[model samples]
Target: MMPAEDLDAEYPEDDWLSLSGIQHFSFCKRQWALIHVEQLWDENYLTAAGHIEHQRVDDYSESELRGDVLSIRGMRVFSRHLGITGICDVVEFHRSSRGISIQGREGLWEVFPIEYKHGTAKTIDADRLQLCAEAMCLEEMMVCSIPEAALFYHKTRRREVVELDDSLRDTVRADFQQMHQLLSRGSTPSAKPSKACDACSLRNLCLPELMNKKSVSNYIEMRLHEFVTDD
Candidate 1:
C-alpha cells in the first residue's frame, strides 16, 4: 500500500473535485463558473433531456434484492474535504460477515460505484475521471479502499471499469482545488475555444466570438500603437 502523503505528493498540483464537476469543468470552465460559482442555470433541449434521464436515476426507489446482496440506485455522496458535492447513479452493498471497523483494515465490505452516462462513450477522459473521483469519495466516506469503479453508458448499454489509480485521483484533486482557487479569486479565465464548445449549454452566454473579438482588438491595438508618437 502506498502512503497517503506520498500518494498526494506524487501529484503536487492535483486537488480532488466533485465527480459531477469534472464533466462541467471539461465541457467549459466558463460554464462551470457561471453555474456552480454564480448559481445560474437555464434549460435547453439537451439539458431537458439530460434532466429527464437523471431524474430517472435520481429516483432511488429502484434498488433490487437478490440473495444476500442489495443493489442500490441513485445514491448521493459529498466530500467536504474536497469541497464539492454530487450524486452517484448506483451503489451496490453486499451483506458482509465482518463488521465495520475504525482501526481494523481487514474486513469484507464491497462497494461498487456505477455512474450512468446519458450518451455513448466520449472521446474525452472526463467521464471516466468523474467516476474515479466518485470511487475516491466512497473510499474516504466508507473507510475502505475502493480499488476500482465503473461507468455505465446508457447508449452503449455497457459498463467500463475505472481504476482508482493515483493518476486519475490526482487529476480530480487538482481540478477541485483549481476550481476553488478560481472561485476564490472571483474571476473567470479567458475563453478557451475547443470542439466541446459546440455542445456547451452556455455557449450563447459565454460568446467565444466576443472573446475572440477582444483578443483581436488587443492585438491590433498593440500593433497600431507601436508607431504612435507624441507631438
Candidate 2:
C-alpha cells in the first residue's frame, strides 16, 4: 500500500501558495503561479465583487440546521500536515438515525461540502476542480470520506454536484505539484490571450494590450515581406 505520507505530500503549502491557489490553478496555471507565487495582483470591479462574496462567506460562525443536520459556515480549514488549506463556505453533515442498518451493518452520517460562487456556470472545469480540492481538504482534516461536493452558482441560481473521482484527485495533485514547481523555479508562464483574458481582473497588469500589439506588429511585418517578395 502507498504510504499516507506519499498521498499527503501531493498537497504542499508554503508561504508562496494560498488556499486560493486551488482557484487560481483552475483558471490558469500561469496566472495562478503569477499571483500567488510571484505576488503580482491587480484588482478590478469583478474581482472586487468576488472578494466581497468570499468575505461574506468566510465571516460566519459554526451552527446547526434542522436539529438533525450540523452546518459549519466560513469554516477555516487547513492541513499543513497535508499541505493544503482553504476556507469552506458551508459544510453540511447529515446524521443518520441511530441504529439505522445498511447491508446488515450500522450506518453513519456523511459530509457534503457546498461551495458558493458569485458567477454563472463556466465552460472550464476549474469550478469543479475547486470544489474537489475543498473536498480533499475536508477529507484530510476531518478524516472522513467525502466522495462528492456541490457548486452553487448565484447567476445560474442552481447547484452542480461534482464527484471526487480519481481523475479529479489526479488533477488536484498534479496542479499542486506544478504550482510548487513554478514557484521554486521562480518562473512565470507566458501570457496566453483569449476572450477570457478580457474578463480577468489582472488584464491590465498582465498587459494583454501589449501582447496584442506585439502580435499585430508581427503579423504586419510578415505580410509586408510576403507582399514585397511577390513583386
Q: Which candidate is the best by TM-score?
A: 1
* Candidate 2 runs further than 4 Å off: 1-16, 80-82, 97-108, 212-231
Residue-by-residue lDDT tens digits, candidate 1, 55-146: 88877788776775567788777665566567888877655765244333344547878888877878877888788877777776777767
Give the whole-model CA lDDT for all candidates, comma-separated: 0.72, 0.73
Q: Write the per-residue lDDT of candidate 2 for residues 160-181, one digit (tens) a residue.
A: 8888898888877767667666
Error of 1 at 93 (Å): 1.9
RMSD of each: 5.3, 5.9
> How well does candidate 1 match the true structure in TM-score terms?
0.80
